[model samples]
Target: MNSDTRPLPQFAHAPLLLLIIAFLMMQPLSTDLYLASLPTLSSDFKVPLSTVQLTLSLFVIGFGSAQLVIGPLSDRYGRRPVLLWGLALYAVGSVLCGLAPSIELLILARFLQAVGCCSAVMIARAIVRDAYDPVHSVKVIARASTWLSLAPLLAPILGSYLQVAFGWRAAFAVHTLLSVSLLLLTFLRLPETNLHKNPGATNFAGLSHSFRLVLGSREFWAYALPGALSYGSIFAFISGASIVLIQVLHVPTAYFGYCFAIGVSGYLSGTLVCRRLLSRLGATATFRIGSAISLGAGTLFLAAVLAGFAHWSVMVAAMFLTLSAHGINFPIGQSGAVSPFPRQAGTAAGLMGALSMLVAFIVGSIVGATHNGTLYPLGLVVCALGLSIFAATRLLAPAEAAA
Candidate 1:
């Protein structure tokens, strides 16, 4: 590998890679690990299912919004301090969540936890951008994503067991412990990768200009919007899968996690395939392929729903296909979005994350609101989002070719 493509020299690549993967895993672990507990949470707090679901939407909102500030701060101050503080806050938030006595308190704590966890996510991307050039960054991100997907693969299974044995609070307790461990590892191991830190970037004027530049870039929008929609479709399933599977389709709660793991396996397979294909087909071709896969999967899912074959197997199969597409598209979209603004990597990563999470929040809320004891809402939203992804990619083809 070219020196520019390697990780920073002060740290060993293996250890640094592990740390970054750990950082990438936090967000998914935080959310997915407790998915099996949503019904339990609803019962515990004596709230309706929709109210319990708000906790997730709120987390997305807080997590997305926090990245807007954390990214700029990382650019202004340094990655290490921001990461350390974020992890500490995440630990505090997780502890509070574990002890929360009401749905209201739990929602607030989840938001705080999300805000803190967002730092690890956005900053991990920034660090990859900081440490490597665009080409290598994509590969690194793909590998990290493969590792990240494992969280979802295992989290639900582990969470189901926890919920079955120790109750929902155990999940938050685990999150607290993980956060503290990560904080210490970050403090001791992770180095300052923002060698070109712009102290002025924290100022309002500088921040505004950077946001404008990133938001104004046609290329970024072209790359990001489809990926965000794809992500939103997957999150729609995440937000509603438990209800659909456990309540509607009547899958046993214990086995629900195993079925969920099947979808994550698709994502893992896609990322592994993406790693190989990135070298051969390059990002644009690979991205198009992923989008097409998602569109096709969405179409099939809708057709199945329309045909009244909305079984657990059908839902799992559709989710597997859609998530696989996401696995392929996400790293490529992220790499493409940040590639043009190497100097403002933090801002770019943050904005992209914000857009993606905003889409998630919207989709989650929609699913929560429209859920009517069937998979219709999930199918409709996912299919529509997939169509949007396909159209966006087609519309952007000329611009991509010119670039």
Candidate 2:
């Protein structure tokens, strides 16, 4: 088979590929795993609920900020050493989190954990770009995301079970074990992907020039911004849905996890559908279908609420469709953004992750602030986000219907 024209493999025992996917999947797990435990953490530390929420925001800020620095460092050095070191630090942070005696310390540990987890996420994407052509790279990323979606799917239920079975500290213990595994895997098999690792490009001019290359491309915004905004909506849900489901909607606390899992089921289905159709249907086609469904879902949600169809089942079903749309679109848009710069994949990924997380941070912060005991605030943001996504895509490809 010609190198670029080969059929995509749906399964691989390639140890390096498995290891990288594991680490990438784990990043989201770290973010999601703590969600169910946040209340217990607050009670344990004698802190207010909002103070505990700060850890979530703080970890996001650190995770996003660290990528800007880590990407360049990995580019200069190699993916393996960087990943190993980051995983090592992540393990240490996880231990600290498990042992943290106070809320402040727990928040600090979470930030440190983010600083480490961000490395896996950025490097995993970069390494994929290094291993395959842009198209194949995207397929691989889609497969990776398919696995990663499990974190959100299973984390809440698992976290709740663990918290009840053991304690909040068990969540961090889970973190520590996986962190160590990734660290060892990196040491054993992670390959270097910086093909153009010339010493000269390490200077200020080269770095500035990297920004120029990325910024100069309208393609970046066309692909990145829509998906970023849509992805940010997920973050909005993460920040707001706890109260909306458990408090406002009068769902039991334990059952709230099922609500979260319902959304994840949508995402998983979207991921599966996207993966199946990705190579056959182009990114734009995939996005158009997914976004339309998502927009419809969001509108249906608003209509349901207004019509007083706010039964738990109704809410769960609407959210399921909405999040499934996210699953369909997230990987497609991400593939569009990172597939362009094969040589500078680390920098490419770094830029995308950094900006995407920054957007999520802003949206998440707003959700945290505007949170009331109702779903209106969250639903409004999702609707606006859906509309914004439709506008961005239409602007990006004005001939969407024609295409």
Candidate 3:
């Protein structure tokens, strides 16, 4: 089963591509599809907005933390079993979320759901690394990212309708059904892509060594940290958007999905551009350009809010530009992080994913705590993260060029 020695059984390219896209979509679908219900959930459970927001943070924490275990397990065992088990857990979590009568229960359910959903994300990245060479890996990841952007683009719009038509719980119900269907498909169609299995790597001693190999690499961190910060800024927006849009600027709940979609489109557009630019400019150059744009857009956003022009349209436009920068940043960062460690792809993917989600959770919690019914907090936080990305990219450039 050593991937280096044995050839993988060829599967249908289209079907496999579709499944990978589905796997990549699950995390966002779980989170974004239920977001329009945040305000409703707060009212239903008789909790404050901040308490409801804690569920989001907890989910991210669970999701990020679980990757530490899931990634290594997949590297030790195989991708298929781990993926099926993860989807099953997600299904159970979603069902519990749908049935929960208390906010506490719902928060617990969301955390479990996040933990389960993370397997899909980590495994999806691992599979790409397993199947492709380093040169083609970035292209494949960029394509997958382009498709992944659709989840954010469409999930909120669909979730909004579900919330309006049924209730906040309806999104979870739908999530449960989708997870079950994906589980069946994985069992039936998905082949074991991880031909190389490090059975000993599951032990604590081996796990620590694998982690050190990933963490000790300056190139890995140089790409991963900026990418994670860039990606986390989106979560910051997700956390603060409901209050800023619904409470402060007074956009109706039903139309909130459309507004969110506008910003997500920026990510989609950036992915498209990344796909084209990757061949010409290469990852590091493209990533640096994206970092610059994101920094500029975030600065503009903060200035707008500071200058008292905190209209919904202005915020959305600024976010759109920032997200576009994210579109370019994410795939390049992810591909770069895992590319150097071919044998330990799962561990590398897991570490990178964990750091990103952990950062997102921290930023999301900060947004929740700083909720003052204004766009100032969100703007400031995003600007700070954007600046951090710029700084990281600058620091990494010399090492990146040498590599």
Candidate 4:
């Protein structure tokens, strides 16, 4: 169907918005909820922190790579079927993750779980495109992201408690249950949103063309680069924070969630700020401010660590500032990247999401590899990603504003 020429609905129904928020939450929920268990996992499996880190880095690899296919498959078939199957796979993978006896097995399971969970996030953006015009979709995504931040805010806290009470594997048990529940909800309540299905989307030539169409657009990279880097900064924290907070700084494992929650609260706050800024300033202006905050916060963080202020509070505070900026940049980035390709929204969403995860995987690997039992590496990564985000914004904002 030629949806490119048609006017999309101005807004999505309220129920669908809830589903989208819930779907989007899967990504954070998958990682953050078990983050507090990283140390415990390392101890239990008789492995080093770097080996345990593989679970996360590999999950990003699977999640990012799968979206390349899932998004196109949704565009070829429809969002509903793909989502249903994805949730089911997630449930199975979660179960496997909980049952695995070895770190290697757990890493493999995480990759599987990630592959399934990718559908929720990638399709959520596509559905937004199906329902709204580009400009309006940005507003909708930003507002939804405000609610979505709650996952990261609460997941770690909940995970910490769950770890103390039952064990690290409890997180996967919860994931299994949640995935099943979401699966039922999808099957019963979620309607098909991809009305403009392109039969050729899954074909090799068609997929390549769709990719080129999105990639060739200057607008997509402008947002995608900043978005990926901001997320990379956050991932740097996610992959490294537990060790820093619990091992180096001597924070209690049980208390780690509260500290993590404080940083994530920045994301919630940033999303609120994002909605306000978008109303008054527009996308390009919002990007500029957000990127500046990210760069400035990252610099302060690295400087603090370098000056021998290697405190958990410093790390958490720095994360809070940078992630708050992420809250601002991410929605704008996602909407902007997909905006130019109405008919190729799934392809655009997938490609953008893939880039974010790819950057995250690289960042996570670096953090893992460079862990010298000190704060310097994490600080360097966050600062470098922030600088990159600022650079990308500077290059794109003027052009976007002019356009």
The candidate scoring highest on lDDT is: 4
User: What does each candidate score in C-alpha RMSD?
Assistant: 1.7, 3.0, 3.1, 3.2
Residue 362 of model 2 has an lDDT of 87
**Model 2 ranges with Cα > 4 A deviation:** 1-14, 398-403
* Candidate 3 TM-score versus the reference: 0.96
Candidate number achieving the greatest TM-score relative to the actual structure: 1
lDDT (Cα, tens digit) per residue for candidate 1, span 1-403 = 4443468565444466788889989988988999989998988889999999988999999999998999999998989999999999999999999999899999999999998999999999898888766668889888889988999999999998898999999999999999999998888878888888898788989998999999998888877788788889889889999889998998887887899999778899889889888989988788888989989989999999999997899999998999999999898888888888877889999999999999999999999999999888899998998888888876865463635
Spell out the clash pairs found in candidate 2: 266-324
Worst 10 residues of 2 by lDDT: 4-13
lDDT winner between candidates 1 and 4: 4
In candidate 4, where is summed lDDT lowest over 10 consecutive residues?
1-10
Tens digits of per-residue lDDT for model 2, 91-171: 999999999988889889989999899998888877776666676766666777777778888987787677777888988
Where does model 4 exceed 4 Å of error? 1-14, 398-403
Instruction: For model 3, name the residue pairs that clash.
Output: none
The stretch of ten residues in a row with the least summed lDDT in candidate 1 is 1-10
TM-score of each: 0.97, 0.92, 0.96, 0.96
The local lDDT score (0 to 100) that residue 312 gets in candidate 3 is 91
Tell me how candidate 4 scores on lDDT. 0.91
Question: Any runs in candidate 3 off by more than 4 Å, and if so which?
Answer: 1-14, 398-403
TM-score of 4: 0.96
Native-to-model Cα distance after best TM-score fit, residue 365 in candidate 4, in Å:
0.5
